[model samples]
Target: MAKHLIVGGAGFIGGNLARELVGRGSKPRIFTRASSSLVNLVDILGSLDIVYGDFLDDVALRRAVKGIDTVFHLISTTFPGTQMESSVYDIFSNLLPTIRLVEICLASGVKKIVYASSGGTIYGEPKTIPITEEHPLRPKSAYGQSKLTIENYLNFYARSTELDINVLRISNPFGFGQKLLGTQGIIAVAMGCAYYNRVLKIYGQGETVRDYLYISDVVDALIRASERSGSSIVNISSGFGHSVMEVVEAVEKISGKMIQKEFVPARHGDVKVNILSNKLAKEIYDWTTKVDFQEGLRMTWEYLINKRT
Candidate 1:
């Protein structure tokens, strides 16, 4: 059995990935910040070895990577309203931690590294629909640019130092355990608001289309990427997109509840439409998204309902 390390494993996607690894009989060590919430990892606490560490601390990061066969780097930070305008948080906060992790991995003799990149922001306004890995990198937000920068650095390190690195540009993943206040998942937040009888605010006519993937599918792709041996960048998405209105409609249909919606001005740095092509992921890791939009919405709604009850 291989020993795997999940940085930021207390987060939404990282928690799911840790559970999946435990199910597969792999010993997964989760490194999370001391101040981070443990709600996502509460159920699996007994099964996982939890390390309280931060990526910015080089000593802690190296300690976490030591003796690990593979690493899943998923640590990132973004201010709620200032994700697009600021480069300081993206550079000093995100990029610095990533660079340190890369250095630690190189020195520690880790076999492979699976990095989580942003599929939503990296493509910017999208020059092509169902964006593939070959699309030109035109990141509009500082968040996207920072992720791309780390990705390019990974490529350079792979070429120069013979390190095995794989990047998974994940789309919007929604499901249980997702932080309702997080900006990434509109579906999760809408479902929560609808369940609690709050207004479902739709930014910009609810026409912004996104490739919504289930969290389970995202975990599946991450695990598969870690198991496979190769240095490649692949898009982890459903390869299909749904508008904000479409998602609300699906939620309404599933929960049999009417939702009050308010259409607000278009958010700054918002992409009108973005979808990622998973053909390359399919060919590379033999992975494809299995959950449809409607079904995924139902599952998420049920989870939230169960949590409330």
Candidate 2:
């Protein structure tokens, strides 16, 4: 059994991964910011070895990686929409620290590290309907560029130092425990707005496409990536594509509330379509998404409703 260290164990995917680890009897160590909310982690706090620190702290990062066999790189300080406005902040705060962390992981003698990359933005626009891992990387957003940069560095380290690094280019993931107030997460945010009867803004015609995977499916992919012997990048996603308008309709149908909408100009760097093919993930990890779109939306809506009330 590998000694686990999760870099951002308090966020949506990170928290779910940590919970799954604890359920399997692995006492994982987690590094999180002191200001990060503990709402998602409350159930499993007793089982985790918590380290409160920022990634920019070199000493804290070194301490977090010490004696750990595998590292899960899941923290992100910037999202695609807002990253361009703060490019320098993204580079100094996110990119530089990640480079340093990789160096530390190598020095710490870590066995392998799994990087949670973004399939949603990394490919920019899709040339084919369901994008495979072989698709050309033309990330339009600063956030996607940063992720690709880290991925390239990981490849370099893996080849040069024989460090094992795996990348999961995951699509948009949504389910319970997701933060609704964030700039991203259309599903969760829509549900929250409907619950309180707030106006939900739609960009362009609201026809931009995305492949939405459930959170548990993503957690499974993370675990499988950690267990694999060889290093590889795979798309962890639902093979189906849905439009933003479709998501709005789904939320309204499930919640029995009309989601007020205002059309806004589409944001720059927003991709026209992003649908990932899970063929590689299935062939490698024998993984498939078990949750249907409507069912997953219903589950997420109920959780958001209950939490709101």
Candidate 3:
């Protein structure tokens, strides 16, 4: 069993990935900020080791990566919606820290670094359906640009050094424990509004198509990336598209509640269609999204209901 370190382990995907790794008895150490909430990892907290630190703190990060065989990089400071925010902040908050992380990983002799990237934002408007890994990266948002920038650095590291790097361009992920009413994850937000009788905000015609991957499937891909030795960049997605309107309807049907909608102008950087192909992941990582769309939504809804009661 290789020693594993999970950076930003308090976020949605990070939390789920931590749960899975702990269950596997790898006893992976979680590296999160001092203020990060541990609610997501509540059930398994006692069985795992947790390290609190800032992403830019050299000493804390160095301590976290020491003696770790595989480091899972899951930190991201900005969302695609924050494209209007300063690109400098995006670069400093995400890109710069990642560059520093690579240097530290190399110096510490870490075996591999699995980076979770955005599949939704990286490939702007798709010329083809089910966008493949080879699809051109034309990001419309600074958020996507920063992620692509990190990928470029990792590619450069791969060419110049012996560091093993696996970049998993993950599609829009949503499931249990996901934050509701946030700017991201329409599925979770819609369900929450339906249950709470709050208005669910819709941008543009609400027909934008996006590939949504359930949380468990995402954890599987990350685990597969860490278990494998060789380095490869792959797209992790459900290979299916879901419109924003489709998510509202799914929530209505499953939760038996109508979501009041408040249509708003679409943001500038929003893309009309962005679905990803997982063929490369299947071929290399031997992984596929096992959760059905409706089933996954149902499970998420049940979790919310159970939480409130």
Candidate 4:
């Protein structure tokens, strides 16, 4: 049984990855902050080992990396509804911890490390549609900037130390186990609001396009990336674009309920259209997204409804 260490394993994506590992009969350890919500991880609480430690704490990180063969670095502090001016807070809280974690992983002799990068924000306002990995990274927000900074560090580590590192530039991943408050998953938030009879709000004209891949597809990409060699950086996306309004309409159709939507001015750093091309991912990892958008929406809505009862 391979031992894997997942940082920020309590969060939505991390938690789903951990569960996938467990289902595959591997030993997975979850490293989370002391105050992180456990709602997403409650079902697997008994099967996994939970270690509470701040990312900035070197000693704690050292302990977390011990005896782990693969390290999945998925922790980040930036979220929606956070004040943009407090970018410094996110850097100090997230970037520093990642640096320390890399140091620990190198010292501990970990075989491989996989990083979850932001495909949406990292490229900022894309000069080219269907952005590829080579697109110039011109991040408009501090969150995007921070993600890019970490990706640079990972590239340096791979080149300088010749370490086995893979960076998955993941697009918007939405599905089960998503939190209602975060801007990470628009579909999840919309479904939550619909379930609770709250009005859904759209920024701009709701024509903004994004590549929304389901959580299961993301997990498949990560697993394949972990085992594959060469091409350290690749995009994990659905290669299909959907408008914000389309997502809202899909959610309403799935839930069999009318969702009230309110539109407002676009927020700062919001990209008009951000969709990634998965050709490289398909060629390199031999993987392609199988979940159709409607199917994923149905699955996510079902999961949310089951969890509520």
lDDT of candidate 3 over 211-292, digit per residue (tens): 9989999999999998887789999999999899998998999999888999999988888998899999999989998998
Ranking by lDDT: 2, 3, 4, 1
The window of 10 residues in a row where model 2 has the poorest summed lDDT is 300-309
Number of colliding residue pairs in each model: 0, 0, 0, 0
Give the Cα error of residue 182 in candidate 4, in Å.
Answer: 3.3
Query: What's the TM-score of each model vs. the native?
Result: 0.95, 0.97, 0.98, 0.95
Instruction: Give one digit per residue, the lDDT tens place, for model 4 in 1-309.
Output: 557898989988898998898889876899999999888777778888888898888888888889988888888877643467878898799777787788889999887899999988899888887899899999877788888888888888888884689999999999988877556578998897789888888999899899999999999888888787643899999988999999988888999998888899888878889999999999899999999888999999888888779
Runs in model 4 deviating more than 4 A are 80-84
Q: Please write out the lDDT profile of model 1 over residues 1-309, one tens digit for every residue.
A: 778999989899898899888888876999999999988778778989888877788888888998988999888887323455578767887888887888888899888889999998888888888899999888877777888898988898878886789999999888878977556578877776777778887888999899999999999998898888868899999989899898888888888888888888987777888999999999999999889887888888888888879
Pairs clashing in candidate 2? Answer: none
Which of the two, 3 or 4, has more TM-score?
A: 3
What do the candidate models score in CA lDDT, each in turn?
0.85, 0.90, 0.90, 0.86
Candidate 3, position 112, lDDT? 93
Question: Candidate 3 at 233: error in angstroms?
Answer: 1.0
Please name the candidate that would achieve the greatest lDDT relative to the true structure: 2
